[model samples]
Target: MSRQRLEHYLEQMTLDEKIAQLLQLAAPFYDEVGDEGQITGPMESLGITVETVHNVGSVLGVSGAEKVISVQQSHMKNNKHGIPLLFMADIVHGYKTIFPIPLAMGCSWDIKLAERSAEIAAREAAVSGIHVTFAPMADLVRDPRWGRVMESTGEDPYLNSLFARAMVRGFQGSDLKNDKERVASCVKHFAAYGLAEGGRDYNTVDLSERQLREYYLPAYKAALDEGAELIMTSFNTIDGIPASGNRRLMRDLLRGEWGFEGVTISDWAAIKEMIPHGVAEDEREAALKAIIAGVDIDMMTSSYVHYLAQLVADGIVDEALIDEAVMRVLQLKEKLGLFEEPLRGADVVAEREIIYCEEHRKVAKELALKSCVLLKNNDVLPLNKNQKVAVIGPFALSGDILGNWSWNGSTELTKNLAESMKVISPSNIIIAEGCSIDKITEPQIHEAIKVALKADILVLALGESSEMSGEASSRSNIKLPEAQLQLVQFMKQLDKPMVVVLFNGRPLDLHGVYEEANAVLEAWFPGSEGGVAVAELLYGAANPSGRLSMSFPYAVGQIPVYYNHFNTGRPKPSEDTTEKYVTHYLDIPNAPLLPFGYGLSYTSFTYKDLVLSSNEINETDSLQIKVKITNEGKLSGVETVQLYIRDVSGEVVRPMKELKAFRKVELAPGQSREITFEITEEHLRYYHSDFSFTSDSGRFELFVGPNSRDTMNAAFRLKK
Candidate 1:
């Protein structure tokens, strides 16, 4: 349908019908609508009539071709204009063939693989009649205490921005109108929901516009730049106003400054929560403020449906605003080609054939293989196949490996550690559940010790369950359960080679397990074929290449530790410094247990002979930075070469180091390669005190290395 036709539909809709177009309800509301157009079931409490349900713009949390087809058929029969309903769901990482969570995908540092995972998710969802997926959550996360860190890529804005664009391209593709295998992408938590105060969910977020623009907003802009079809408002308050009702944030910044013409939506029930947030006095005010703030869809909220029409009638809200919001909804449906084919890609046969298929599972396994970060290895990894291995702990046989937001993933189809290890070395593996996640008895501990004594080595599988992270699951003490720690202490008494395999959602404190274990593998809730991938890495079928996107803190007190932190005036001198008066922790080091971009490969690589094409460059010119990398070990492996820069002096303080660029290369034993990176003025730009984004003329330092903490540095100058 053309713009003129969409406008025509807007003109044809009555006030009530137009108001309904701005409201979004769950699948249960539509499922209970009677044939005579009366509310009969779940929606009765909201006082919503069947007529309002018939005109609802979209449905949430519903899928499968049969259910979607039935609902669409019923809705069209009652809808006066016969406009099709849009189906949206939380297809975060994958729809059915579960892949690793977004944080694990970030650790892989493979943008193409991330895009491929999104493509597979789109294929499965489109076949099941899902038109939009609330995914590619681009919030820049620095605090691991926030449970939703599992949903974000990492701490660095540069890396997260790259991933945000890749996810958008994967979901929407080049032509969403014609591609039946794709679904429109909804980049979410619109502004910074990750910086919630104290890392609590839905807490207040207070930051200067300069701080917000510099660190948090870049990833979201990157998503919009990639043409993501929709943006969802965050639940937190930005500068004392809820994001759903902040006109300066939504209308002035997102729509005005960024020029994002895409649809704007609220996170589940965020529009109505403004009253509790003390911003709106009643539902009428909530509806008025949200629409004026450019929110087009109120998910799971009755405020818009009940109060919008009356507010417009009383001259409190403009009818033009309602027309604009309704027009955006109609334009989205037209972009989806809903007029020509009401059921865009709904086919029960296709849903069965495409979802959870072998091809999709292959990608899941491959990504899982790359997502496992080998955090520590004291020469105990790449175990020999003939060695007798004891896989002990709660995760040994548990199939709850698919992390949060995997609603469609089946635990029955997921492979556990014991199952996959047996397939790799069937005759030499033993298993025992020494303790549960939180509790342990003497008999269970005795049996676990007995099992450990029978094996040549122990693979201690442990960590938080799926409930520990994602959404409202934040924890002040981010450590393993006490029972698991006690289990580790008991296993350490056996004096055997121990490899701690973590199945978790966020970066952990790892105090007990890190010091006691011989090797530690951060296998973050790897999805679907997680077990198979870990087994392959254990036996040397695949090498460990995944790096940490988020830092692992030394202690819980250092809650928000990250690599690119700003240098304080009274900074700690060095590890050997005896200066107690400086800004240093008395008990622990000021650094993280493991830094960002930190990982290990079975094979080793060495960096040498860093060189620059020029020592000084103007704004228009670019500099070529080069470094030599060699595989110094006797195996083939992939290495992520990272480049960082620092502004020696600025109008405002600058970070100690910022990741500017990075590259991944595979090298065989004794191989040498020189990688070159081009740095332009764009990479150096930062928001000033006036909120202007530009680079200043100053001296700079550049560092290139395998990780953030340990690197060789060279000096350069930036000329205006």
Candidate 2:
């Protein structure tokens, strides 16, 4: 399959055949077995025929080598050209051996581990007949009310960019065409879908060009730079028009400026929704706008399949656009080696052995270990295994730990908190379901109190159900459920040393549990091995090394609070300041309850001896900064050393501090290491008022520390 061959095939396709090649339908539409396999209702609703199903370009939401082979064989038999069908799915976190959600993985801050997780996910998915994965979202999330925040890495562009590249490399590998165990990466929700208004899913997004370039666009560019194969258009609007039909976003910027020559597909029926979005009058206009805006594939929409050919025949839309879109689709199929081997890597035997195997489970456990952040501790962690520990809450024995988008993962295969604890200390662990995720009864409370009274230590497993976060699951109040809080209050009266192990998707307010518990572990939806990982850390088998990627607000009023925010003219003077008119909350603190990069380990680390090579540097030169970190505590642990820089003055307003670099160091007791970071001119660059990315010659401030708030500071100067 060369370009000439693809062109020859394109020349042979009829108008209906070409239009069919640009439409993507789900798995049920193409099932030729019986009435059970066919979705007759949707088929009639979309007005598609059997001939159209035979000629469809791709299939989504279908797996298993047997089913995919059956559908492909049937489709090619009826399809006159015998072109292979591309299979895509939302393999977000993991395929079978589920790993932590993207937000939890970001807290690990280990690029190599992140890449390995994606590699395992691809290996499992490729064997099951999936060709493309809509994952590594690359959306910079600031507001937690957005249910899709679980899909994003975090709030910072630089950190998310690093992870975006790791995921792309992991999913596609070095050579996607030759790698049978890898799947094509589709970095999704192009251009700021995470900034949805009111932190609601599919809400409008409005930002300035400069603001978009500065903070929102970097991660997407990073993914494309890493050679991702496909890009999915977002559902939200950019500027005024929806992203799927916005020419400036898709054609001008993504294809023209960024030089992305890959296939572009609309997010689930987004092109058809443009009619209701008030941008298009009907499906005919929607189809016209989407294709002209450079959307190559219309997902789950009849707009392209039913109307594209008519638009071209009417002379309003050029046939070249259809040719180009079809050619890109064909080129992707060829690149995937489908022309040579139509059933590329789908093997039933391999799918069974490679998915949820022992080796993949080990990596999932390791990532889970690094992702559970120790939010609070008053010397009650690393509990003695000999002590009688009561495990009580909805998640104590429940297997809803594998968060959202884990469609292929089964709860029965997961080990819950109670099971893992019993494995470590069978005789010393007692379990009770004190309350459901959102409800509790009087008998349940009484049973919980009785169980707590018998144990020396209480390990309350509590948090939101898996449904509380991840796509279309937003909540206005991000606190623990009222019933669970009441359980905490009743248990607090027992006066036993209590530890709260939270399994959640987003950063929570933690009002009741934070103040009452002696220790709090933020085990955010820690996938298949979440139970084992948290249990190990509890009994000194492993250390808590995870940090917070997103900030935890003290109250819901502080919705958008983050460490990288800009300074205000009427900024709050100080924590102790009693100023009347400063930008301080009347009843709450301006700072978040837990800031980004904030976490606690079993051991302690100290930072000192900050040194700078020189106080000033020119544009072509680089500056070297060094700091010494020592493991002061008796136990061994990992520490994340963060580097931040502040531009004193710029043509436009700038953040108080921006994360420039970070490195994780492992050390034993009393071990000291000198960490060095080199800062070049590129690290100092920022988007100007006119959207030009460049650095200014001015005084700069540098800080190095474990987290955002607690840091050692220095000064420098940048000269042009």
Candidate 3:
């Protein structure tokens, strides 16, 4: 249908029908076989009529082509207009063939891989009758204690924004109106959801608008810039106002300032929670505030369904607001081509044939390999295929490697490390579960040691469970569980070579684990094909190329440690001998155990010849910078060349270094390549003290190398 047709349909809607278009409900509300009381329990509790259910704009958490076909057929039978309901779900990582979690995908530092993963996910989800996926969560998370960090791309704004754009392009392809395998992307947790207080989930956020614009808001804007069709309001309060009803945030900033005409939906029941947030007196007030604040859809809430029509009637809310909100919903449905074909891509035959097929599984396996970060390697990796290997730990034989937010994925399809190792070293492998994840007895350790004594090498597979690091699963202490550490302590006494493979969600304080093991691989819950990928890396079939996207702190006290932190007035002492009156730690080093972008490969790379085209340049002229990189080892590898910049002086305090651009290049043994980056004036623009985008005339320092810490540097000037 055309825009004019959609507008005509919108004009014909009654006040109740228009208000219902701004409400979303769960699958149970429209279940055909469920009991009447069970189906309507949520409605009765929220005081919504059954009529509102039949007219709802969309449905959440429902899938399957048959069921969606039934619901759409039932709703169209009761409604005067033939508008189809949009189906949305939390297809965060994947629908069936689960890929690595978002954080792990960030570690890959390959934008094309990230885009391909989302493309595959969209294809799988569309066949199952899902129209929009609340995914590509572009929150910039520096604090690992916020369990939702698992769903975000890492700490860097530039990297997160890149991933955000790629994910959006992948989900909503250029031809969304005609694409049958695509779904609309929804970038979520609008306005600083990652900066929750004390790194707690749903906690308050208080930051200057400049700080908010500079750091937290760019990723969402990047997604919107890529034409993301929807935005979900965060659950947290921003500067004493909840994001769901913050007019300045949603109306003035998102719509007026950013020109984002996409439909804005509330995060799961966030609009109704405004009552508990002490901002609204009741559900009626909540609905009034959210509608006035420009929230288009109330997810899983009756506040809008029950009171929005009455608010328009009483003049508490303008009727034009309802028209605008309903128009956006109708526009989205038209773009989705729902009116022409109500069951847009709902084909039962396609769902069965494409759900977890071989092609999707292949991409999942490659992503699992690319996502695994080799944090430390001491020539002990690339173990001989014939070596007598021992796989021992809590996760050695467990299939719990599929991480959080994998709603449609199953662990039953996942192979354990021992099961995968059997293919490479069939008769010489010994496997034992050293202990349970959280606890271990002496007998279990003895059995593990006996198995370890028989093998020449040990692969200790361990880390947090999938339930330990997502949504309300925050941890006060970001360390390995005691049982795994104790098991490590026992294994350290052995003289055999040890390799520690971690399956976790967040960056862990792995100082002790690194000390005990000769080699460590930070494999953050590598989905269904994780076991095979680990085995391939172990036997030299695939090179280890993944890098760390988030910094691993030395201790829990350094919770918010990141590479892009601002320089302090009294800088931390570089040397331990002069620690007095400085920001140095008395017990540990001030640096992270492993810095951001820090990862080891089977081969080594050397950086040299940092060059700048000019010593100074005007604001309009592009500055050229180049560096030489050489693969000095015998194995072929992929190198992620990172470029960082620092302003010598600025209107506000500047970070030590901020990542500007990165390139991933493949190099053969003894191969050398020269990479160049152009710095435009736009790259230098940052939010000033007055919250205006401007650049100050100053000297600039540039660094280029493998990671953040160890780099080759040069100096240049930016003139007015």
Candidate 4:
């Protein structure tokens, strides 16, 4: 399965066989039994036949060792060259032991943990016969209205880039040649899929080329730099061209400028979608554009299978392009060692032994604990074990904590808050299902209140169900569900200390519930052992250290609010005072309900004594900034010290602040640590108005604090 052999195999392939390698179908196409197993969503209409299915190079959405074995055996029997069919699935978070969603995992701010999660996912997925995972979705999301925000890391380009590298390393590992536990990583939605217009799914994205490079494209670069094996074209159009067929994006930028040699695949029939996108006249034209644009695989589409051979025959498309695309596909199979053993890691014994095993669940539990963000607290957390506790809400005893993209995971394994808490103190805990997620009845409220009256403390577990957040689930109004809000209002009348444990996939506008609850914990779809993790935080077994990766808007009016927003000509007041003509919201404050990088712990850390090695820095030189942090509160905790920088003056306007660097440190009570950050010219450079990625000689402000909004600051000058 060497390069030489791959080339030889390509040379022996017929025009139709080469075209077959560029086409990918689903589990249904391989079903020889009957039409019952056939997925007629779009394939049947495409006129794909048994012959075309036999020649398909890869299969999508098929898992399990037995199923994959059956499919591969059937495919190889008919594949004249004996090229193995690549098995790909959307194993986003975890395979069996579901971990926190990507957004929540980003909140951990622990890159090592993020890497471990991907590694675990790779191991579990590989054993189940999945050769590729469309993961480490390196899209930078700012608008919460986008339902797919749950799939991305967060809003910051720098943070997303860091996570992108970590996940790639975790998925592919160091050596794909020898690694059995790793699966190939496909860094997806190649260009700005997160910046959909109106914050709607698959909407058009329009941005200046400068803005594209400055804010969106960095994460994809980071992933590719870390050796991601493949790139998936986004569903949206860049400018006016669909990403799957945009030659400027695929050939000029990705292949020409970036020098990416990996295979590029269209995202779930995106090539055929070019017709609906108004770029192509028909499937023939779509196939020509995609293959010419260097797309190696047509995922779940028959555009290549139906048109490519004829297009090549008619001289509309070159056969060399077909060979190039087919070669890349074969090269990936060689790299994955699928050419050597068709069933690479499909060991049924290993699949059974490793899936949701105790070791895997322990890591899942640890990640879930680290991902829970403490949004607000009023000396009511760390509930006393002896105190009578009432766990009242829809999620209190429900096992629906596993988030989206948990393909092979089981909710049956998920523990509820009440179930986990009962293990700590069976005699002191009372439980009641207040109401359904979006429903509240008088009888349900009365029953919840009856249980609340007997308890010294009330833990209200609330928020959206798992279905309300992932793909195609965008919301115009991000407020709490009406029935859940009603339940909260009813519980407010109980006069007991209440803590709100929220389970959501996106950042919510918590206007109504934030004021009524004594403490609020953003659990954010913690997976598998989520309930146990929440119980641990409630009883002081684990200190909550997760920070907000995406800003929680104060209201839905401030939809696209983020930390790194450019200043306007007419700026709003920095203070709480109102101004008539200044840029300010008429109804709500300009700030978010909770700012980015904001989180609370059982303990507290105070920062002081900011000192710089030099007040001035040259273009080639680096400056070191030192800050002292002390754990002031009683309990031990982990504190994420965040560093932000802002250009005082530029050719164009600059954001108020941009996160450059951060570190998470664990400290015991009364312990002091000095954190140092090295700032260089590279950190100061940005895409100028004229598209030059260079900085001007100017004064820069540096802020070091717990969150973006509250920080101690200093100023320095950069001498060119």
Tens digits of per-residue lDDT, candidate 3, 55-162, equal: 889999888888887777777766678878999999888998898999999999989988999999999999989999998899999898888898998999999999
Off by over 4 Å in 1: 31-40
* lDDT-sorted candidate list, best first: 1, 2, 4, 3
Worst 10 residues of 3 by lDDT: 32-41
Summarize candidate 4's per-residue lDDT along 228-338 as a digit string, tens digits: 999999999998999999999999999999999998999988999999999899988998899888899998878898898898789888888888888888888889998
For each of the candidates, the C-alpha root-mean-square deviation to the true structure, in angstroms, is: 1.1, 1.3, 1.7, 1.9
lDDT of every model, 2 decimals: 0.92, 0.92, 0.89, 0.90
Instruction: Report the CA-based lDDT of candidate 4 relative to the real structure.
Output: 0.90
Q: Which residue pairs in candidate 4 have backbone atoms (N, alpha carbon, C) closer than 3 angstroms, thus clashing?
A: none
Q: How does residue 102 of candidate 3 score in lDDT?
A: 96
Return the clash pairs for model 1, or none.
none
lDDT of residue 253 for candidate 3: 95
Pairwise lDDT winner, candidates 1 and 4: 1
- Model 4: how far residue 89 lies from native, Å: 0.8
- Model 2 Cα displacement at 69 (Å)? 1.0
Whole-model lDDT for model 2 versus the true structure?
Answer: 0.92
Tens-digit lDDT track of model 1 for 138-219: 9999899999999999999999999999999999999988999999999989789999988899898988888899889999
| TM-score versus the correct structure, for each prediction | 0.99, 0.99, 0.98, 0.98
